[model samples]
Target: MSSKYSLPLVLSFTIHIVLAGILLLGDFSSPPKPTPTSVQMEPIQAVIVEKSKVEAQINKIKKQKADDAKKLKDLEQSIAAAKAKRLNEAKRVKELERQRKKKAREKKAADIASKKAKAKANAADKIRKQKEREKKQADEAAAADAKAKRIKEENDAKKAAKKAEDLRKKKAAELKRKEQEARERAAQQKLLEQQMAEDMANRQQARRQQMMTEIGRFTALITQTIKRNLITDRSTMEGKSCKLTISLAPSGFVTNVVTGQGNRIVCEAAKTAVYKAGTLPVSKDPEIFREMRTISLTVAPDKFN
Candidate 1:
């Protein structure tokens, strides 16, 4: 038999033995107490006793005892078997409970592992998104900086080009003015040479030409001086001209200047320029004085005010 059923079988066998002893002892307990007796007259007769009848009574008693012992032994064996069977059922129930508890623990462990894995995945996704956002912002910042730098470079280049163009125009105008002055001087020198060679042929014509030559040279010098001092406002003096009557001393110093005719603003600008010059060019030749003193000079400019 299985070890778990051994104790219950033993206990059942002991209980059956105790019950059989109680039944046998109850049946043969000390003879019952003697009953009361009374005397009586009786007829006497001769009685015959048989040997075979006595032997048969003895054999019947022995057979009854053997059957009782056999019944008792069968009862003990049946009780023991029933008890062992009950103990086996109890063991089956306990084994099933242990299996149930083990399965429950395994399932709980699996659930915990699943939850941990899911949590890790969620954390990783959050970090990835954060890194992507930071990278996108960095890229946008770099692009904006590049755009601003390009705009600044283009503006600087435009300013440099405009400055160069203005300088080139200024230099060209200066070169043109010098060439014009040189040509005028050459013409004046040729005229003076022509008049010197023919002085005896026409004294009056030669004298007039000489005076004209002196006047032209002095006027050109005065124009150059005034041009340097003049500050023009195109809005005020565009397409305007003026005549100035100037009284000069023999020493090339101007004593007075008066506006003759033209726009008032143009005349005022011209007078201011003449005064700023402080003096006019004068010929040392006394004969040139008649035309130089109290002269009316036209102040006109085509390119500048």
Candidate 2:
């Protein structure tokens, strides 16, 4: 049969052969000898003698065989049971080992996948950060360039403004100079006309002396008049002389009077007296009139005081 049952079968056969050999040896060694009889045997006694020994031996062998067979049967049963148990245990251990190996493989695969995913994520993050840094740098550079451009533009505007202002100032100065020159030329022309007219009349020297004398006489007359018309204390008017310049029109009427240095009331009275004189009794020469119309007079009330 199978290798597993071979040993039990061989052991049962060996036990049976040993028991049979013992029985055969016992029959050969104890063969039945002639039975000594005291008297003639009965027929029933002969029969009993002839079969009794062999029958008793056969009965004994039968009982031993029955006991051996029961022991062999019990032994075979126990061995079969042990083999069944060992086989079941081996199968269970193999199944457990297979499950363990499968679990280990799954765990290893999961670990590898996780590591790859983590590496990929790290790489992506690194690239993103690098791009961001580059973008930031570019922005900074652009801003710097923009700032420089703006500063340059501002400086250019300021320079243009300054240049325009300088031009305006130069133009204003040129106009002012031209106006001053024109005014000087007009004054010179008027002086030349007066000189020419005096020369034509042939009374230039005499007219000048007469005009000087008349101006002096008028000044003395104004001083006396102011002294006489004093409404204030005479001592107050005694200290200073009132000098004035009066402008007259060609018709000899006073056009304007400017006080040089004098008390306010005395200057006012002197100006009024000069106005009352209307036209001075003098030559009508244009040369003389031109000088006399713009005369300087001093009214010193103190001189008459």
Top candidate (TM-score): 1
lDDT per model vs. reference: 0.79, 0.74
RMSD of 1: 46.9
- Expressed as tens digits, the lDDT of each residue in 38-122 for candidate 2 is 9775798777886887778767867766776687678768777877887898899999999999999999998999999898998
Model 1 bad stretches (over 4 Å): 1-201, 303-305
Candidate 1 per-residue C-alpha lDDT over 25-110 given as tens digits, one digit per residue, 9 for 90 to 100: 64565334435568545333311233344445556655656776787778777776787678788899999999999989989998
Candidate 2 regions exceeding 4 Å error are: 1-232, 275-282
Query: For every model shown, what is its TM-score relative to the native structure?
Result: 0.33, 0.27
Best by lDDT: 1
Q: After superposition on all CA atoms, what RMSD does each candidate show versus the true structure?
A: 46.9, 45.7
TM-score of 2: 0.27
